[model samples]
Target: MTDSKLKVALVGCGQIADAHLGEIRRILCARAVAVCDQYLDLAKQAAARFGVPGVFTDLGKMLAEVRPDVLHVATPPHTHRPLALQALAAGVHVYVEKPFTVDVTEAEDVLAAAVAAKRLVCVGHDQLYDPAWQECRDLYQRGELGEVVHVDAVLGYDLAGPYGRVTASDPDHWVHRLPGKFFHNTIAHALYKITDFLRDEEPRIFATWFGALPGTDCPTELRVFLQGADVTANLLSSSAIEPSQRVTRVYGTRRVVEVDLDGRLLRQARAPTLRGPLVKLELPWRQKREAARSLRRNLWHFLRSRLHYFTGMHRLFTEFYQAIRTHGEPPIPYAEIRRLMAMMDQIFRSCRANERLSALANEERRLNGQPVPISPLDPPLTTHHSPLTNP
Candidate 1:
């Protein structure tokens, strides 16, 4: 809450840090004054590359020296909690990366810290602010999509992508050690988009695993079915034949809106207005018109990307900084973060239980000298309508 420009410091100098720094630069009221990493060289490199004036190996020392108004925690999921708590305790606002913390309990702890410090905290559920995703939300809010009857968030990955291939080859990669493994690192991007529309508290989740490429370092494929009070959602993560994909679709009683995030496409499909046999004659033109309009909007966004690539992130940070300065609500509430972590905990537990059951069945087959077939395990949990809103 300073009248002058807010001084910001970033603690993690990873790949995502580049986006954070870029967005911070775009904020006229804030500047990234210092950068810190445990490895001094990494910090120095980031400082040099980004022209950050101050670099320090020790977080506490850096905090004492500059005392920036906000600290961005861009480290791995495992390090988020401790680092965030440290910043909160020092009376500094914090903007954390997603999956907020590794688990529900830890997320609650961070929330408690924010409460005690009387500061604001926000998570990096940046997809909710993405232009395409927000456009879909707007349609639903405007009642164009009607009540959300069902939601689908699909994430497609290439096991051979540069980062994916590196993680797959290195069993000791930090990603493999996460509680939910590959799913934890990627599933948040899927769940938050659907959760944005779901207001039900106590949602029931049943998950199934498909080891499409079994030899990968971690489970690279998963499907979770979630049922809420009145809305149902499916979260799918898989290493499919496609190179990559990130899409979220909302189905309503009136129309359906599908957003291809990676492709920057948003399309809506509805039943044709014409009736009788003549309906077929007019439907094709209407469909083509819809497709053409979507392409036009997506292409506009693509051209704008040349100026600012992380537009969603830039918007998120700008709103977050405004909250800190004016003492308003955070861009994303803590209660939402709590609910998200609870859902992740459920997914991890269910997936682990499924894995254990499969192992037992495989052992039984070996004991009987029978062949074990490659197939997905039967989902052990049931999905039911429970309007319990935990957040």
Candidate 2:
């Protein structure tokens, strides 16, 4: 544990902030010094629950009076850019939630602010910390999985009950009142994970398909064509399921791996050897169980699976601590996050236009004045094209 404790301010008191608070307690070098929210009562509640002494409804005032070392922007997506810019301008490290901003343009502005302030700016893409995903990525990098050929990821659930109502609420409601679109909130996590694993070559969308959600105007389906590793990645999400589930599959030349969202179990299948038509092997789970035993062990695994939940908060505090101590970039840098925002914009545009959108490649060509090269890992753009039908 670090000897110095970093003073942290949480800017939102929503449901996700509770998870952030938990992580803050876990990190011995951090303390929640202040809380801010549009709702004073909510802010007060968070402060009381977390043992924070300062509470305010205005972030500007909190920055002025408390001058927190780090500001955690846990507010809605639309407010992410402004709040993050404010924190960066104040010379405070910022940890903003996913979909960093509503649009790529706003994302660029956030990046510029971070560069100008010389302060670290990290976005919450916490799933990268999951042990299972980390293990899979490590193996892939070691050439154990061979060349990744395809990726199929699904992030969706049925929400026909109370959850459905929340998703279908008025546009003014915090849940539904996004400045840009809902895809950024829901699918960005999966996309980030996908891109992280396939970082060698960037994937461009060749096509998109969409569906309807009962209560909301959000697109329910996004089938994207990745034109790099001869692969296709399909991302499907909906607010219409009874219970939610997330699964990711990576198909490689030598083996196939599947990981559930919680990262509890990672199942893999390798190519057949000379023994017969097929030879299958599984990771050593029995040995894993023997290595550790206790409630804390299981709880830690559970925490690892939901690591993304606390990423923003953890990053916010960690960056602030690092900024004051070492003066370096945060865990998540701004350039990579800008790429994520741009990728999301392309995905949503493809979904809305009912066609494969080449926004990213087009932008690259416009900037560099060169024809985009084919991505070896992505499927051919012209082969699997399913365009979205605009409403």
Report residue 58 deviation for candidate 2 (angstroms). Answer: 0.5
Give per-model TM-scores: 0.91, 0.77
What does candidate 1's lDDT look like per residue over 18-132, in tens digits? Answer: 8898889878999999999988888898888878999988889889999999999988899999999999989999999987999999999999999999998999988788887
Worst 10 residues of 2 by lDDT: 277-286
Q: Count the backbone clashes (under 3 Å) in each candidate.
A: 5, 22
lDDT of each: 0.83, 0.68
**Cα deviation of 8, candidate 2, in Å:** 0.7
Candidate 1 structure, TM-score to reference: 0.91
- List, residue by residue over 319-359, the lDDT tens digit for candidate 2: 54665567655666556787777767766665545423444
